[model samples]
Target: MELTVLGDNAAQNSAGGGCSAGSCGSTDHQVSHLPDHIREKVENHPCYSEKAHHYFARMHVAVAPACNIQCHYCNRKYDCANESRPGVVSEVLTPAQAVKKTMVVAANIPQMTVLGIAGPGDPLANPEKTFETFRELSEKAPDIKLCVSTNGLALPDAVEELAKHNIDHVTITINCVDPEVGAKIYPWIFWNNRRIKGVKAAKILIEQQQKGLEMLVARGILVKVNSVLIPGVNDEHLKEVSRIVKAKGAFLHNVMPLIAEAEHGTFYGVMGQRGPSPEELSELQDACAGDMNMMRHCRQCRADAVGMLGEDRGDEFTMDKIETMEIDYEEAMVKRARVHAAIAETLAADHAKVSAPVMTVAAGTRPVQMAVATSGSGVINQHFGHAKEFLVYEASPNGVRFIGHRKTDQYCIGDDTCGEKESSLTTTIRALEGCEAVLCSKIGFEPWDLLEAAGIQPNGEHAMESIEEAVAAVYLEMAKAGKLEQAVITAAA
Candidate 1:
């Protein structure tokens, strides 16, 4: 694969005086000059921001189910429906199935902002499946963020592939920078079609991981290093790994504890290896916290995990349930647009005497279009991410009328593939161009930001069953708040 090492001169003049730690420096003046694709890395990614975590949610699709390395701590199974760990998924989904499930999840869980390809196995080991899912998502759900976690054996060869897909976040499991320490953690690695074990495998894995880190950081991709804390095995060495990755421009370091449940069937558990105590884990995190940002809130989610951290909604949108629903590919571009355009014309003739709403729903008083996230009921009952289509209506003194509906691809499919001219969210925003307000039972930070950026009001509140009733209630609330008049004055000014 051909690799492009960004020129150092560009970095010297780039944001934050050279993109320290693969993050935009204090000044985004330089970043503003970057292409739109590059500027989008940090917007609503929950793992990258503490604030985003509270408001934004993320999910992982278990499309890749193969591995090139064997760690004593790993024992992946695909048959279990309730196991909640990295290698356990209820079912293995094809790229297409994964995309479908992601769409449904995103529509139902609007707060979901990032889509990752974590695994029942190494994502890079099953590169075809991983990239195929990514390619499909790029074309379908361009607004969502893409991320991957790897064991680092194939990272050097896969870094360019990640960039090609516009994937900006990468997590590499690096328990130690020392090969001797690594020997205790990873038992064997498949290299060049041969099984390499002991210190040789450790050394090779370490070299590739470091090289991949340097290359990723140079390309301005955010990197997070994950270190598993196994009591008496590389636990004391993670601090040094933290120092190494941080020096190589890692954005964050996550020190996770080994899950060594004997009944779970992992090699480590079979060997009776013990996981670190809470105190041990906390001490190590603190020791390395000064060197690099330490991620304290990791739940070690399953491959098919969904919803916010600590809460798993994977069972709700399983393949069996997803197959029961129907989706229209051209729902927004054709049906919704046609209906919306006609209704808009009628509303215009009826409300000509009324001054047009001064601004989108935020300013209030004027008759502006409103979009609601619903599950086909005229009621706002679905979360922002779960709505397959948005029902658009005109709200004014004349009352609310069915305008049209805009269709959105499953957002959790993955981020758009690289070099796409427009994102799915951008397209959705354009479809709702004349709309002033968006209503949903729940809203995520990313969608909220996108709507707000387009100058539309995002109303994250529940509404009455009937569309007219909901609009009337919302309008009355806006009037009582004394916001509509202010919006009119602002618009006139």
Candidate 2:
């Protein structure tokens, strides 16, 4: 894998590209501990000044309905005035048309400096439109900064093209660092050699993305990570995500709220629930304040937004709007998918799909799970310990129940940021040893495999946030089924 990391050197916590990694010596937040290359990028960000950041400098043009990942929290079939949705097409502009529209809009509102393609479809999933827009803008309007948000499937190749056009900012939507959560979000991915489904597909994507981010950062591209704070899925994982991205070179962190619009039929709200409120977002920002720059001015615009923050350039975004555009949503979705597949084939050094272990739950417990890491990122101490004992596994009475993890040492021991965490695959298998089931917020490639090896079956996605609630829920469910003994036995075992 050609590892090129993308991150904002100017905004990083470390300093100097060649500095030896160590405890960040400075307590200063204004001056970055990140290497000089990355530090400069953050320092130089045009948005650094309060006067430069007005809500309207960027726009999301949702041109297609195709996306590679189905985030448990997303339904691309809808539209949000603030968040990214699947079906809402303000308009589906061809690359040429998009460029033309952007130029035209720029004339009316010159404050717009960033032209971003966030999308009803993943930008990478629509490479032709994504890149072509960049190509056109480069030739027509060189002053505007080019930005794109993607699943990172096509990023490895797209980065080179973007850099060629002097593009500076990029956003990648990363949720959980685990794979089981990924399976819940993504059904299939054209990864490795063949198309993989469920957990395998998720693993491939996470790895590819981690690799791609590194490549992007190494080349001086600025990366802002958009992490949806999915409560039960990866809420606790935020601090870790911030740490890793900061280390790898991400500049700004955009922790967006999971907008669960009922009409969308996407996630969380299926239970007729609401997402985290503004207060919750504040707490999360406080929690993630460990040397990471968090994005506070997110309007969560649709993929195809046009105009300045205060200005209503809504007309510039008139591509997929049924009232104005002629393109069908389904057709645009198909085109987007084709572009995504093509981009994946263009990037990613092909690898094989690694098989994982398949352990079952004991009689009344959740399955034992494992955490997979990207290269270089080894096991973080964040693994839930007796924390595993708290997750309740819901299965048929006749279905197997996961007992518990016998070990926690190497179970969480592995690189999450670097791809070498594969070695921990062996460690994970051994950690689960006699365990029959697994419990986790998410899973990734190799760790997914290890849990399978130890006979641990994935319990799938869970909504447990606090460590205690997860454990208590397990026993509560077992007791309700008159199977609490299994929990006791597992505790003893």
Candidate 3:
């Protein structure tokens, strides 16, 4: 049978076979350049100041795109689900050839510590190709780590083979433990040369997969689980996977964001109609956190990616490279002019105006925009003296602050000042009215509407606990870039 490889999506946690062909980097692109204001805004985002906080340290190469089982949600037309999981296959390679591609990648990226085989198909289902490549790599480049992600349908049979090859890590995509929901996602399971479904097949598959995880871990292999955080399909099941796999010795839990691949010819389009929001994604991650390490930095690289941070690799990747040379002295460069364009367009607008990009609430929905308010002759209320329920999850530049209700202390506006305003619904609304954005655990609709109307951006989607801390991050970044004095809020107040 002919095999095809489709690039992986967002971060390779889901979509297709997890090759992430869609998000691959350009071989010789330039670093994305941002305007001063946009750069300041970008710096405020955690990725810039504390990137280590969200990095995943592995890479993948797509070898096979064929699957033995037909999942209700399964769309194996593409070799990888990453870029657009259900698209037509763009590239395909055998395991030996895939390894050669990976070695070329390892040379350019020293931090790419682990190598994985994810596919257009189930990695274990194509055991010979998967293990054959692993065996070859073991002999040619013994120092590099080997990893594989599978559907778990064929995992039990491939366990010994993987162990024999000294494979160190594995990522399995298990959505639900219950057969009812399982049936919706998985159409038919091949067992005994017959198609099985309902609870029987689900039970058999989950049991064997779980047992295989135990066996693999028993052999001293590290296990990582990639669970899709699909809202209704198996939202609650995530906690269970975390609980079960953690018990079975899985070390890392990568709760991936589901890609809503439009027009990728597949059953998923007919099965589901939407994708998860940033807020919803955070909710699953928060709910699923447990003893298992959660991987946040998954770039979901392509099956042939060869640079750190999913930066593009030039022509360095090939089937021959896998036989030798695990590291590349020079890294590949990426050009991000388009990404920079988006950032600049949003930032250069007057922060004070309620523009299209500005924070603004729609007629019927929640605050749909970040209305950039007007800079006024009236005194600026940077800090609302009224301290309400404040909670700080992480540390920030501004000393300790609250995420819940508290008494407001510092009123920086001109003297003859208003006493510390009581932390009330009115005060919350007033505070958000003046601030560009507010990041908190939750907010009331009353305050949300007021903030949007008054030109404040409600950063309600983030799961962070500290607002001042994030603000401080923005401050420090501007300071380091030599733009702080003019760009930052003054302490004199």
The top-ranked prediction according to TM-score is: 1
lDDT pick, better of 1 and 2: 1
Q: For candidate 3, report its TM-score.
A: 0.56
Evaluated against the true structure, the overall lDDT of model 2 is 0.52
Regions of candidate 2 where Cα sits further than 4 Å from its true position: 1-51, 63-65, 79-87, 192-195, 271-273, 310-312, 316-493
Candidate 2 steric clashes: 99
lDDT of 1: 0.68
Tens digit of per-residue lDDT, candidate 1, span 1-493: 1112111124433433211221211111222333455434643455654323434568999898899988888876424453456788878899999998877777666666789998879999999999999998888877668899998889989989999998989999888889898898888999999999999999999998999888898888888788899989887788788877877777678888887766567788778999876547656775665565566556677888887654578888889999986665344224433543454354334234332222233433565567777643235766776665576665654344443345453223343331234566776776566666778888889988998998888887655354445655676666666655543434544
TM per model? 0.60, 0.55, 0.56
Model 2 C-alpha lDDT per residue in residues 392-451, reported as the tens digit of each score: 222322222211112223212233531234443454455444334454555556555656
Q: Which stretches of candidate 1 lie over 4 Å from their true place?
A: 1-40, 77-79, 328-493
Candidate 1 RMSD computed on C-alpha atoms after optimal superposition onto the true structure: 16.4
**Could you give candidate 3's per-residue lDDT for residues 1-493 as a string of tens digits?**
1111111113333433311212111100000222343233222221121122112234566666667677654465544322423212346677657666655654554344456677757778777788788888787666556878787888888888888887756778777777776776677788888888777888777877787877777776656677776667777777887767766666556776655443443466555546566456545664554233344434444554444332434235545444465543223212122333443343333222321121122222211111111111111112222222232121122121111111112222122232344545555454333234555445557666776676554544333422333433433433455442343244685
Residue 458, candidate 1: alpha-carbon lDDT: 81
